[model samples]
Target chain A: GGIITQTPKFLIGQEGQKLTLKCQQNFNHDTMYWYRQDSGKGLRLIYYSITENDLQKGDLSEGYDASREKKSSFSLTVTSAQKNEMAVFLCASSIPQGTGNTLYFGEGSRLIVV
Target chain B: GDSVTQTEGLVTVTEGLPVKLNCTYQTTYLTIAFFWYVQYLNEAPQVLLKSSTDNKRTEHQGFHATLHKSSSSFHLQKSSAQLSDSALYYCALSEPSGSWQLIFGSGTQLTVMP
Candidate 1:
């Protein structure tokens, strides 16, 4: 039983401000991902790390940056917060087994830009 | 260009009645995997079922889904709806042979009535 922990259950940032969200996983998984969840939009991938120091962009990575400082920790940063950009950010980790890479997700951090 | 579409944004069913959530996908790859994830309130999404083999049914927690490549669908079904099943369900796609990213659908919110 592994767990993914995301810091700051809620965040409020001003327009053009930079904000960071942190995630830590005890699963010792090889892959970590950050996703943004908006109403009626599902969850869109923002960034992912396959290993320490590795980063890959996803479908919605335009204004976000990610860093995998350690195998157990991954972080995401909002470059410049946009007003009314309210969404839930999720962190997940997975261990690839054959073709079934089952993902485990964190509770999520809700961001509200003013 | 691969995407997942969960047709029902919200589904209401009476307790003990059969329930089904439709999920269809568009993928160019031959070998792909599908997943059903359940998210309760204030909790992270968890994998309920996963299937990679075409025409094979995958079951978990009394819920089942079969990957039908011919129809490009993997719909989640349950014989009886329970109040505990009232939650948000997401359909996801994994392309292991390509970007190795998990693409998710908009999600279906299931409400079990007493």
Candidate 2:
């Protein structure tokens, strides 16, 4: 049983400030993803990486950037924080299998923009 | 484009009563899987149930869901609700034949009261 760890449980940033969230997984999974969770909007995919150094954009990728530095780590960066924006960013990893990939998520990092 | 829809944004139920959470989806892929994820307070979301077989039921932790391809629905159900069952539930779609990304629904917050 491996674990996914996300750093900085809470991040308070000012408007237009740049913030970065980091995730590390010990599952040795080949795929990693970053998702944004809003109060009523649910989880929206920002970016995903199928392998190390690979990146793919999702529906909510406009304001975010993602990096898959290695097989065990994935990171997300908020380009420019919006005023009064508050959301939780989640990081997940999965390894594809015959049945399907079951994502394992980190606790999440809450971003609060003032 | 793939998308998931969870009809209820919030549901309050008395303990020991039957509970149901509706989930529907739209997808272009023929072969796909549906997942029910539960998120406890301040905890990461975890898979509660998953099904790829059409018209077949999958269950975990006393929660069950059946994937009905004809209706594009995978609704979660439980015969008895417990106070500990209160949490946020998300319905997700995954195309195993394609990328490893999961498209999530708006999510439903279930508050089981004693």
Poorest stretch of ten by lDDT in candidate 2 chain B? B94-103
Query: Model 1: per-residue lDDT, tens digit, B28-104?
Result: 98878889999999999999999999999999999999999999999999999999999999999999643467889
The RMSD of every model to the true structure, in order and in angstroms, is 1.0, 1.3
**Candidate 1, DockQ score (0 to 1):** 0.75
* lDDT by residue (tens digit), candidate 2, B7-29: 89999999999999999999888
> Model 2 chain A, poorest ten-residue lDDT window?
A92-101
Error of 2 at B48 (Å): 0.3
TM-score of each: 0.97, 0.96
TM value for model 2 = 0.96
DockQ of structure 2: 0.77
lDDT of 2 at A20: 95
